[model samples]
Target: MRDFDFHPDEATVRCFAYPASGTVVNDESMWVGQTRQASPYDTMTEDLVLRHFALADEWFKLNATFDLRGILIQPGPPETSFAINCDIATPMVRVGEDVSAVDLFLDVLVRTDGTHRVVDNDEFEQAIGDGLLSTVEARRAEEGLVRLLGWVESGRLASLVHDYALDTVGQAPHPLPVEHWDVENVPSVAPGTRPTWHHG
Candidate 1:
């Protein structure tokens, strides 16, 4: 197991273990992680890098990458894309020693053209119906979605990504310690105590 994990729902958690690297920033207010793997597209020979940005108190976890060649095979120039995971709870939490997780519900994909698409409505509703998420959590998720869409609509998402990427460049990623993990039993952050960041 690694220090970083992502929980798509209460029952599901994916850890960024071995071969993946990450680091905490701004007094543990943020976590940046990256994994490099072979390109899944036949048209590309270069490896693909998937980077994750998890900010404390935010309602979403952001995954950004420049590997658009596979999906945009007809591309004229390469473009970066952002995948936002709208979380039902605090976006990031340290569940244990060197271990953190993000609880997610909905997803939004932002393209380079300023166009975006929201997905996973069915899953979100299913989670609610299945009692996986409470009414308040669902409402929080909805609010997060609205804020995220506002970022997209105002072109702020692009700028945020660009600025964060620039700020992280040349910073070497630190390896997470591996240990026996139990994602199913990870602890939750206390309500009303979640840290937040105000974007200027």
Candidate 2:
């Protein structure tokens, strides 16, 4: 443990600001290794973004989940009737637990760490987890590029991914990752606001 020197003003400053980076879309799938590969910061290609949709679909159909909370696995979620899916969420990104095999609702599920738009002590650790998850996402973003780059470089992804981006689209519906919630430098989603600059 570190030592504590809690004078009034110092303690006050510490209380308000947490040990953190600005929040943004943080999914573990974006990160790779110990580094934050691709972030909303890096440039993204249409195909690179599209592949993530494919990966998320494959993983969902196979019931594969990469929970950021670590090694926990999801037992099969309660199956929903094939005829009744109206109760599911709207803009209904990915279908939650409930549906027949052929009845899977495959759509683009955009997970934004929108919750990070504002900070709170309740999910501070979760925020850090989102940042780390960037490594997973960045890799996903450039999985193909990395593969190609790997072929060009030492012939391996284990080699040339010193920097990657972690902004992947998913089909799973779970609690938002840390980075998704914060939007310090991002643009506004206000009325008449069109998506001008595509960062991630």
Candidate 3:
């Protein structure tokens, strides 16, 4: 804890802004270890839900996530199925002492059907052009992206995901817990907005 520069007196929810495809995808949630899982919220039509895990070792930290929307985690051809994905290390910044935000750059989306695609290249390029990220940082992200892609092609990424979740799923700590609620009842604000939720 001493080495960690940012420390909060209590758990604070932060809004993470993600510009994906053509629009900005915002998730407001609390930090759980190195990850943040957004609270279930309603958008214009459907619901948006996600869980992200940033795992670290001595060399580098890799990010993996289960991103889903709508009601159930339907199987098979995936009509709103579970997407288990890994990507380059998400670059983040501390908004305050308690809250942090990260950029999901060049993520490799690996689905349950053993199919894959690389996404968010335009967003990553935009980040670099806008001076949101430096050349070195961009290079690091690119390198990480390549490494993750190689893992995916070699079947190592799936193995890593299985091993990681199997070992840590039940053991990892949850710093903030969302109260049980239906989709309509879940807290929601405007798009790209981070709601202020304090846990004492």
Instruction: Give the CA lDDT, 0 to 100, for residue 192 in model 1.
Output: 26
Q: Who wins the lDDT comparison?
A: 1
**Mind sharing the TM-score for model 1?**
0.69
Where's the lowest-lDDT run of ten residues in candidate 1? Answer: 191-200
The clash tally of candidate 3 reads 0
Candidate 2 clash figure, as a count: 36
lDDT for residue 34 in candidate 3, whole number 0-100: 23
Q: What is the TM-score of each candidate against the true structure?
A: 0.69, 0.17, 0.47
Ranking according to TM-score, highest score first? 1, 3, 2
Candidate 2 lDDT score relative to the true structure = 0.20
* lDDT at residue 189 of model 2 (Cα atoms): 15
Instruction: List the global CA lDDT of all models.
Output: 0.54, 0.20, 0.39
**Candidate 3, residues 15-56: lDDT per residue as tens digits?**
333322111112232222322234343332222233343333
TM-score of 3: 0.47
Write one digit per residue (lDDT tens) for candidate 1, span 41-131.
6666765545567666667777665442322112123343334333334466665434464454688877666677787889889877875
Ranking by lDDT: 1, 3, 2
Two-way TM-score contest, 1 vs 2, winner:
1
TM-score between model 2 and native: 0.17
